[model samples]
Target: MTTDAADKPRAMEEEAPPGMRRVPGGAFQMGSDAHYPEERPAHRVVVDGFWMDATTVTNDQFAAFVAATGYATVAERPLDPAQYPGAQPELLVPGALVFHMTDGPVDTRDISRWWRWTPGAQWRHPHGPGSDLTGLGDHPVVHVAFEDAEAYARWAGKELPTEAEWEFAARGGLDGAEFVWGEELAPGGVHLANTWQGPFPWRNFEADGFTGTAPVASYPANGYGLHDMAGNVWQWTTDWFAARHAADPAKPCCAPQNPRGPAMEESFDPRQPQVRIPRRVVKGGSFLCAPSYCRRYRPAARHAQMVDTGMSHIGFRCIRRDPQNVQGKQKP
Candidate 1:
């Protein structure tokens, strides 16, 4: 059978509609002074009103896009010949990798102990070759790169939210709030977001009633009526990743308006020149988030990932604006 025909999944056409919400633009504290050093010097940023997804894009939503566009994700596509000039022929297989958590601590020196280089892990098959999105129709789509996200946004007539816009919405109308809900991660001893609740890599207390990804609206919405903005999956933003602090004295005191990230670096990764490092910011934290490991759950906290590397905990949301409704000045 032809490669194109062989690659099609039987359930390709099934997907749910995308969920969206409108965010009012105003001034909000963009970074946190207490969290990661990169988020230090919290600054006030103003953003124009825009429409955003109430929740991250779910498996079903992405399945529909695949059905309509016949678009293969980076994980599904084979490595480009020109990119990897001298890569081992064996490593050129077309597939995405999966990281399965074992019951005990394994040696960190060898990544194969946890991350399996599965050849079939894609949006439809999240756990590698045999798995399918049969029951996870509502779960956020995993293993999606920035390119895949951009393709979906283009098809849907929307765009990825900028870091400022994402941070503002994540605040849920509460300026300078520590989290999406407020100061406490779980107010009144309640698990608000889908996050690691128990011992790392071993016992998952399931305090949040979820050991993995939860449904889109599994938790309460923030002040802006956005759900799953603090945890579950890290949503991709349009800004480039810069290590500089938002309030760094080296830069101006006045915050940037509708800020975009830094320019792409011309120099390539000497180790892997095949990969171009374009700057993009990822907001919110993921299920793997923990104080012991990654504490990106904070509003101002951010992380930088290559535009091409997609992981199980990384997903995205879409945005749009009417362009006619201007708003009041952003507050400081």
Candidate 2:
């Protein structure tokens, strides 16, 4: 595969779909060996030119989608009684998982200390019952399940980026760099993205000017001129979750082009045998990532999110593979 953008039109010079930025075709090192186990065995990958959203999809944009299609997000609809089997009726109502800071310190291994299931919680009502999108129109829409993202992408005539594609784009031509901007998480004592400032779960100094989700584009854009790729909220990708990347051939001959994830069946969590829900890859950590705990705020970092559920920290953007197909912006 070609590693030169000169082989095709330059990304910034060409016309891109509205709210999107063109990523020039290129090959780059796709993962990290030093960070998490899932990012190990860093391999080479190539992707064709594609247009990606400048930022994570925002609450106002998602609301426009909902209003146009009368689409209710997964969190807005009632849970299937058959799916839950014998759960309480109250627990079967429309709701979503929300994050709440714990008092002082607690067991970091147990996530339940900071997360709770709140009834009537959805994208609009992020906090659960009374919270609304009031001043958060610019914030990335949360509590959107994988299906919800797909719906929004479909409405916009775009699709979710593959894990390889997302990683490549998030790198912003800074191949193998630690963070999106550079080696340092916060270079020169400046916050480049909205990541957790202090300790995890219990304490957040809000040094990045945000405790929860920050509004889209609150920080500097990467080389591709895309924002919120490192933090703020986790973005969904089309690829299914795998423990690690498959081993690859040496540099001379084998660079996978547009590589995808493993089969859906392979995405099932071995740790959870009873629940059969498959997981998809979510990139770029959220505000929940902290130095003391989750350090997945980097581009190579990835997590497996259950397809059926959407938490308050998960959101997504869209991609357009065929630039010719982009017709301005969707009415919705």
What digit string (tens of lDDT, one per residue) describes model 2 on residues 1-332? 24555735565566768989877778888888898888878888777778899999999999999899999989988788999888888889899999999888899989889999899999989999989999999999999999999999999998988888898889988998899999998878999888887777888998889999998998989998899899899999988888889788766467777778888888865546576778999999999999899999999999989998879999999998865533222211
Q: Tens-digit lDDT track for model 1 on 1-332?
A: 00123112311432323566656656666787776766766776767766688889999899899999999999888878677678677767776667677688655445566566677788888887788888899999989998899899889988787788888888877887788888887889997888887656656778888877888889999876789998899889877777754453355555566765555663233334556666468989988786666688877888876777667788999887544533321211
TM-score for candidate 1, residues paired by index: 0.84
Identify the candidate with maximal lDDT.
2
lDDT of 1: 0.75
lDDT of 1 at 257: 63
Which of the numbered candidates is closest to the native, going by highest TM-score?
A: 2
Error of 2 at 121 (Å): 0.1
Worst ten in a row by lDDT for model 2: 323-332
Please give the CA lDDT of all the candidate structures: 0.75, 0.86
Q: Which lDDT value does model 1 have at 309? A: 69
